[model samples]
Target: MRWWQCRLAAAVALLAAVLALGAAGPRSPAPLRFAPGGRFKLALFADLHYGENAWTDWGPAQDDASDRVMAAVLDAENPDFVVYLGDLVTANNVPVANASLYWDRAISPARRRGVPWSTVFGNHDDMPFEWPPEWFSPAGVPPVHCPPAASAMPEPDPGCIFRGTPRVELMTAELDRACGLSRSSVGPRELWPGVSNYVLQVLSHEKPHDPALLMYFLDSGGGSYPEVVSCAQVTWFHSQSRFLNPDGRIPELVFWHVPSTAYVKVAPKATSEVRKPCVGSLNEEDVAPQVAEWGMMDALAHRPSVKAIFVGHNHGLDWCCPYEKLWLCFARHTGHGGYGDWPRGARIVEVAEKKHFSVNSWIRMENGSTHSHVTLSSARFS
Candidate 1:
């Protein structure tokens, strides 16, 4: 029964323990669990709002700062693409000049990275101006009956000529301005020729079994003014939505400049005064109807294919309330470039397996050089 038997039993026990640890070794750190095969990464930043008078002085510097931060981020993450959700410029009633500068600066970084970039229109980009009266004096009266040529129109009109009183003169002026005559020699002639709005289709590098994605970039006009959707653009959007075949799968991503729903309401600060619902003001009444008319709520409610909507009008970070299956996110503005007290920042979005996504917000430090990244997992929706 003996000493040899006892030693044999101890040896067996030791071998069993070693085997157990070996079996569990591969599982220790846990495999990267993603949503089935859906695994890809992308970066998103919205409401850069470049070119405000205050920040104009530092526009180039801020652009360089943002460019550096974004370059570092893109180099580190190596996302598939990048998206800017609008308000690229602070229109400031100078859409022609200011928007051009903003676009150049705001996009210079992404362009430098050699990455594909897309965007939607924000309210600020659509800043409007009134038309001079001579454009519309009724026929048979005189040469005045003919709409004033673009050269003759006044500058600094308070209202949007396109949708305000004196509709005829305004419409003509809009045509002239859009045709690249008013602010000639600046801005992209094609882009400035008409209201900028369009749909973009993004395909994945992976196979059909892999996660497929498409982004719909809508032009939500600007401010609170009502502008009819042009017949051509509407038809085009409808066609794009219907025809997109993402590896034979539906669109998995939808991006826009404005929230489909009113995600934020003013909980007035103690010192703030009540104000009327105006075209440019941010109030319940002004925002609510705009949200409705654009059919944003309805589109979001029914479009199961749309996994998310990213926007940036409010300039503050926000996540969807009630937590729907869809994810909604707001990116901080970079317009401060290097001027404002608010930290300039951008967002990084990671789309993982099973339709799961994560957002990490980055803020430009006070030094106006470095960016501090903050994980926004709290805002992550399944």
Candidate 2:
């Protein structure tokens, strides 16, 4: 067999092993429980752009850095839960099936450390092959097996450059298999439009049904679609929040890959416009118009229970600024695959088991320095 065939075979064998292990019934993750004093620490790892130069030394080395960051954070914080804020891998250079390897490696640190974690999709997570097939041809012509009409279909044709299973599907499957207790068995039923929109409840006490905090994970519709949090998703969020808390009183923190448009206005000067103390680099980029504001911002503003929004798209910017009645924040880019040579780190948010349901958050670098500690809540922001 040829080199690509060999790689594919190896990847397939590895994937089969993973599936078998998942089927063999590994112990489900225990429910998230806080330490004494009703305090739970959660770590946010972002932009772990694994697979920069797949099947090469540099790419694997970059992933090693991500592993080190995760291991270091897990050791230091002993967090109750962990959240990977997307851009989990740069799979453009690898086969779609082998993409799961990167995901597997990215979450290994957390899994080994015995921490329950979740993920959100970033823009680059499900990208197509880096170079079109024609680039490899002596004649520079795309394969003509599929007709032009195939391009208009919802799924890419086998002959198309973008043809392959999306990395997001593999992601959700792996997460559910590895950390069953952290996610719902039903997997975001018809109520949510996207794959990753699900919730993890932090109980006020040991009772599984009594929820004190609700952690939401959203896909942000990146990769195949425009990177926007859809209106349907916003409605679903409202409905879920109400179903969970009929009195509309539970505290929530939302996590996703891309930031909403509000970040642009709040940090036009690379720093917060408000009087709040924001930290880390403000180096912001032009917000993608497709992803800019839909009604998600409005929904968040109107829902006073959502204490803050945490994201990880723009690797350069890491600030927690006030946008309307919510705190718009970015996770410090933790992977070395993408751009930026700034000191790498992860964001940490702590929720105390208190009556007020306030949150204390900050950033912790690989070297162990911390900054940008802040408290957020609708009452405080309002």
Candidate 3:
């Protein structure tokens, strides 16, 4: 064939392959938007903690429990968009070169349901593994039975490497999935090392021409780096919000894995019971916040458009309290692998299509129980 014909043929083959991938998977909806009834529902799954203790029977059982939790919440809420609010895997406990396998499993529920989703990194997401004393002691390590590896191995042998996967690799792999609706992205190169510092818009159902809401996902650094939102993120927020919502009329919400110091400030007293104005079921532990406050909260507080912020680091706390001009909320523990005896559940956020509407949130537990309903008005924020 001629050079031009050859190039055209190659392009056709590539398109065909892509189409095949899409056809092989579940059908997906259009880019995120409110339903025809002018309402958007979002479900937040936090601290899934997959890939923990793969060598033990109990570990896989816990992962199975986590899967059931996700499946139940997804079916119960049927969120238009889902956010894997981080700690999707206990990287330190994961004895593999790539934690993406667990990450993929964590997101599988949404993918199977054809729901769009996003993710942010948590401290446990990229933590390096610490050698267990038991492995070096009398207890022999279980030989990795994963195909190609020897059925039996010595104690000193490095059967698996758990150095942790980079944020870039995970993000790129998710984006490259077949017909996936993953909105996750590694933001500007300036924020290198901090992936998922991007913004998303939820379009209006009735007026498709305009955006109904603005959502910002930032990398609240953790694991390999200090648990704090860098100054660069604050600057990026101002720049992006200014350019996106010039007049600051559109309502905005923020999502990150680790809770900012502002959460501590707004947190209900550790000993006090959760009440109205503030709403949630569990308050068993104190606020496990970021390392320090680096002006991100100040920037958000100053922005009249920012209505609320969502975080998921403390599995035992799942409350939302008014902070400055916006609300600070924590998603419920949605995994069996984390450090909590609390029941698994997910936080649900719903917004109306109107420019001015109320933002309502509640927790949907695995056993079909829903509680801790709270509302934030867009007009009040405006």
Candidate 4:
């Protein structure tokens, strides 16, 4: 039998064993790889805004709808990995002390299916609590409750209500969960206040040992801090790329929540005919960028190996347009919580395990319809 056939059989048998055992909880992640046919699929669940208004039926209902969307996508695509592409919860709206509870629910579908996953923080993930205006009204619930879970808050809101879970604590909780496949990291100390900055390697289906792809996650700051990828983060990226891919051979893809100013640079004008080269159905809002661009884009632009940057801030936009050497793409809004009545869905990325790989992405709607396909590669442009 051929080597690929052997790998396929092994993967199938392992999956069968896992099904027999049942997904009581996370099983250990086998080594990450594309399917034996040299294809790998990744599902991106973005702007879930999971914990919004937990006290209200509307909030929980939205979460349930989001859960259905994810379950549908997972069943349809059967991705190799999953990425919670930011805004896991609207922390300002989340009354709970530990927001990780909501964050955990956001990635639960992938966990049950035994797919490895990771996350990056969005502006809402750790925003300080904003009291409901109704609380100050005559018919309001008294604003006397203090969060029992949040501790050592560096800065608190007016009432000393829970400041949302800091990035460190959120990422740390996932690491502690023993979820087995949560590749989320708190990132480097030098880049403090910017947790969720880390990298993950997806091994080649052929070599099985060598990393064929490098996926980098950066903390594009928001919430309490300005929504900017700091110069320090750029420096860190330079160091990591130098050490990991000095030759710029392996392909790299980046993930964060907010778009950099570079996105605004390439965005198709919001008003006019709104046609492609940029292929997306919706363009509801202008690019909501970080407060500043302090060199992260330049660094990625200079690197030929950097194929694309995936982000999730704009629920209205889900298109991949070229930005210098790479593509700037917005993941489709996956949660019903965010400000969109449009169809809920996840963005799926597929990569080929070839010497010169092409990364393709499309939006898979909750109704099981897929659209907006684009290839993020120089060859496509050529």
Among all candidates shown, the one with the greatest TM-score: 3
Query: Residues 1-382, candidate 3, lDDT per residue (tens digit)?
Result: 8999999999999999999998898655366788998898999999999978777787789999999999999998889999989899988888876777788889989999999998998988888876667787776676543222222344555547656777787777677672557988889999977888999998888878788899999998887888889999999999999999999877898999889888887778885798866878788888988888889999998888888999999988999888767889999999999797889999999998565576899999999999998886534432
Q: How many backbone clashes does candidate 1 have?
A: 4
**Model 2: pairs clashing at backbone N, Cα or C within 3 Å:** none
Ranking by lDDT: 4, 3, 2, 1
Flag regions of model 2 displaced more than 4 Å: 1-29, 132-164, 176-193, 206-209, 271-277, 281-292
- Compute each candidate's TM-score over C-alphas: 0.53, 0.79, 0.88, 0.87
List model 2 lDDT by residue over 1-382, tens digit each. 9999999999999999999999998675666665657788899999998867654567668878878887877788788888988888785655434455577678778877667778777777777767746567796743332223311447754433333336446555566547453342223556333567878878875444577788888878676667888877877888888888768677888988888787777764643332444444545554332355668788878877788899888877777888767788888888888887888888999998666667888888888878777786546552
Root-mean-square deviation (CA) per prediction = 20.4, 10.8, 5.4, 9.2
User: What's the number of clashes in each of the models?
Assistant: 4, 0, 0, 1
For candidate 2, what is the TM-score?
0.79
Task: Please give me the total number of clashing residue pairs in predicted model 4.
Answer: 1
Ranking by TM-score: 3, 4, 2, 1
Estimate every model's Cα lDDT from 0 to 1.
0.46, 0.72, 0.85, 0.85
Q: Cα deviation of 106 in candidate 1 (Å)? A: 1.6
Off by over 4 Å in 1: 1-39, 54-69, 93-98, 128-197, 204-211, 223-239, 245-251, 262-291, 322-324, 337-340, 353-382
Alpha carbon deviation, residue 378, candidate 2 (Å): 7.1
